[model samples]
Target: MNGVLFDSFQHNSWATKVLLKVCSQLSAEQLATTAVGSYGNIIATFNHIILSDARYLHHLSGNAPEWLLNRDLSNDFAVLEARADEAANNWQQFFTQPVDGEQLTILVSGDYEIHAGALIAQALHHSNIHREQICAILTSLGIEPPDIQPWAYAHETGRGRDLPSEQ
Candidate 1:
């Protein structure tokens, strides 16, 4: 894997952990609160964000398995977290294997194709944007989000801190 892609995976994992921390801070009652009424509450928005990104990531990689299809966030944190872990693992495994790094076609939609690296980049970038939203939700709820920057973790734990900064 390229250095950039590897860094992306690390960052993605870090961001994911931080989001989980934010979610962990919520109470069952607070988790369902809709601060703005129209924003669909914290749980729903977080659920949609995770599921939508996973769906698009899978679709772009030509691996849109039914198991990874849309899901309800209200189900349970365990289920949603499991699915997220699976999605992240799938991406990680794919990254572990060597790709041409040159170019490869992926199913963008009905008969559409996009470069693999570009698609992966899109997925990572898009998720990070939503992750920030999740962090904001945490702050609004009076919960602090972990510092996901590489330097923070490095400065805190040296090298063996944790695989994902969230942990």
Candidate 2:
């Protein structure tokens, strides 16, 4: 019913689709490879990215941490896919209720406080940044990542184009 809520759902759904496509083609070893260097292995990197944002969500809303923060996995593919699903589900739950963007706030460790909407935006942007990293790693592994354009996911899902229709 709210515009912000709608946008959040759409963006996160697109991200989930991208993550699934990425993990689908990689072998377990390749998914766990640290060839990307300082960013950590693909599975670790993905978990880190999702967990970091979830941590912020906890800080902002006092929600409990999602499973990714504490879980260990013996299988790389399972871990990667599960983390993606967990992160998306958590985000979806958070956005299920609408709050006016202005009513949100980000608590600073010391003194500074930021707008909550800005923090949410930053978290999403952070995820997108790492998604690009994952994409790069996938490309290097000779796995073709899916076309993750928002329009593409929307159309594929029969959710229609994100762009405005022509008159």
Candidate 3:
């Protein structure tokens, strides 16, 4: 996979973790709040994002981490953060490999097959979509949402830097 193709995965993980930390501070009641057009309440949306990311990652790489395999998934902040970090590492390794974008991922149960490239695209879009939904929930609750944008990720991770005045 090219750098840009994979780098977004890192950003997705980072941004999700960032937002998770922010949302972790909310009370259980607050976490249950929902906004119009969102996928679900804050807790549900966040959990869906984490769990579903692993689903796509698993299909993409044919390897699933313990966090993905374990059935003890919950809305616990610590568990979510741990899973997110583990997922980030896995995603990093996955990107280090050559990507066969044109390869087909067979789905016998569903009687369907999807291109790896399309799955990858869906994985990227899925996280962004859910994150926005969580942010919308926060906005509706009068809580300022964290900036989980790619620009913010770049700034935080030093992927982006201000160019000093040119000599």
- Return the top candidate by TM-score: 3
lDDT of 3: 0.84
On residues 1-167, what C-alpha lDDT tens digit does candidate 3 reach at each position?
A: 45777568889999899999999999989998988888888878877888778878788777887766764567899988888888778778888878888999974236778998898899999999999999888888888998899899888899898889988
Query: Per-residue alpha-carbon lDDT of model 2 for 1-167, expressed as tens digits?
Result: 44556655566546755675668667878877665443776766666676666665665567644473464433355655565566567767776777555665655344556676777777777777777777788787787777776667668777775677899
lDDT (10s digit) by residue, model 1, range 1-167: 45557656665665675666558657887776554433466677667666766776666455654554534454466666676777777667666667654466655555866677676777777777666666666667777777776666455546445466674
Which parts of model 3 are misplaced by more than 4 Å?
165-167
- Residue 100, model 3, lDDT: 88
lDDT of 2: 0.65
**Count of backbone clashes for each model?**
1, 0, 0
**Descending-lDDT candidate ranking:** 3, 2, 1
